[model samples]
Target: MNLKPLKGQHHVSAITANAQKNYEFYTNTLGMRLVKKTVNQDDTSMYHLFYADERGNPGTDLTFFEIPNAGRTYRGTDSITCTFLRVPTDDSLLYWKKRLEDHGVSHEDIRKGGTRMVLFFEDFEGQLLALISDQGNGGVKGGSPWARSPVPQEHGIIGLGPVMLTVSDLGPTEEMLTEVMGFRKKGPYRLEVNGENTVHVYETGEGGNGAEIHIIERPDLAQQRPGRGSVHHVAFRVEDEEELRRWIQKLKEQRIASSGFVERYYFKSLYFREPNGILFELATDGPGFEGDEPFEHLGEKLALPPYFEGQREQIEARIKPLNTKSP
Candidate 1:
């Protein structure tokens, strides 16, 4: 029997000190829409903002939470960090380089990949992140508002291709990704980022698309200190809650130790720390994001889960508004 397809990545959450700067980068510079603007139910002092293509497509999202006074956390072998956005192949890079340059936002020169081209940049908190040239392979739909690069609505990042981590041991982590998560190894390899060791990498394939998970093997690096402005976790998709149970069984059978499942509104999640200290989540696919809000206005306004709705006034008042002047 064929293994069921993972729901694919839903979205990645990043911490941002200057939610405003993060806002401009995702919206104005990167050409995405601010789908949701709500408060973190856990700590409503800041805003949890979401950005994505029209309709707030799942794979196309790059969301952030605004935390102005958070300290810069250290990243090392134990951290699974950064989110990459994919654009059409035609001329997205030219558009981005000029856009960032025009806004005086710092960005690197175009980075060429075997099949994709990437440009890495830091968010306000120095969080490592990038925008990739997906070359229209993913069902990228809708043209971006950024005029520099025009892509017919069909090549944006369809889903997360890969996420990079620096782990102390590759064994358990590899087991989590391949055996537990269903990613097939395309074999170990090196990625020629600028012809230099931009990173130490291992490649895995899902369906036909490939994702390279990088691990920096230096012993000097320490484990991650998670906090605002740092990545809290990375999530992978399962078809439904039933598949979720199977994943739980697989983890137990393998003695991988999980933190148990947690309800995340619209999706159920189970978290476990791989051997390297990277937080990985197994999330369900059904009751898709659309289950919460109508597709047409997924992120139009502050739509809270029914559970959180009772605290709207308190939540709204607690979060400081977007700083219009970040970055």
Candidate 2:
């Protein structure tokens, strides 16, 4: 059955053991807006925080689920290894290098990631990340940076860039991406990781920095043990609920088991694992973080869907307090 291809990267959700510190680093340090202050829909006992550009646009979102007492993440293959953010220019990389240094955040020198300049870095939890320069990039434009961001608007992150996934074998994963997911193979980039290797690039709608995924095959490594710093899932953008339903049907036709259609309050979603056991999500782009609160005061208070409203008292009493109000 013919279907519309996915637009691009939507959001990446990761695990964070300390919500307070996570907020400090992402908002105060990195200068991303705290778009939503809510709890994990499935597990309301814990917090699910969303950070993004000004309006909490789909492609800009980077979320986290707080799991207290979580263990350390063991780096290895078969993992969603790195998430990237897009900055305006090559000069932005230099600015970020200095900013990261001043914040005592460890980062690598600016270097080439594929054809674009990038600066690799880590968070307090050792979560791997990078900032990719959109110097000569086109297709899938980025989101608007928050004006109130401490990081100057010119140097602030605009949207998500390419995500890197490492797997033991590439055949099944590559086939799933091309045939079922409708991603086109862009090309490969050479790198020396464990040894000399090639990282395959794939893109979906309007192929560019925002719509690409870099896959590296590493049979030499074992499965990654995910903990506080590991990514939980990476979502691709579905235009609307209609498109999301179409995707659900397509997954069934392909005989790939999925979580079916899930109402996320803000947007609908469908969750499934790829051939390598890495979790993947398909989410709608609208009815976003603004649905519950005014755009000007987003993430200022705990927001919950109508279904969870009745249990708000119980939930709030159970979860620890973490203030996310903008000063």
lDDT for each candidate structure: 0.61, 0.93
Superposed Cα RMSD, model 1:
4.1
The TM-score values for the models, in the order shown, are 0.81, 0.98
User: lDDT by residue for model 1 over 1-327, one digit each (tens)?
Assistant: 234645455567777778777777665555566666766656766788877666554445566777788777777667766566666553767776776677677678886644467777766566777666767443323224222212334443333545667666667777766676666554344554323434544443243222445554545666777656687777766667877777777777778889676776766878887776667777775465576677655555676778888888887777665643211
True-vs-predicted CA distance for residue 88, candidate 2, Å = 0.6
**TM-score, predicted candidate 1 vs. hidden true structure:** 0.81
Q: Which residue segments of model 2 deviate by more than 4 Å?
A: 192-196
lDDT of 2 by residue, 1-327 (tens): 767889999999999999999999999889999999999999999999999999899999999999998999999999999999999999999999999999999888788878999898999999999999999999899999999989999999999999999999899999999999999998798854345678899999998999999999999998999999999999999999999999999999989999999999999999999999999999999889888899999998999999999999999998999978662
| Candidate 1 wrongly placed segments (more than 4 Å) | 1-7, 136-159, 187-212, 226-228, 323-327
**lDDT, residue 120, candidate 2:** 88
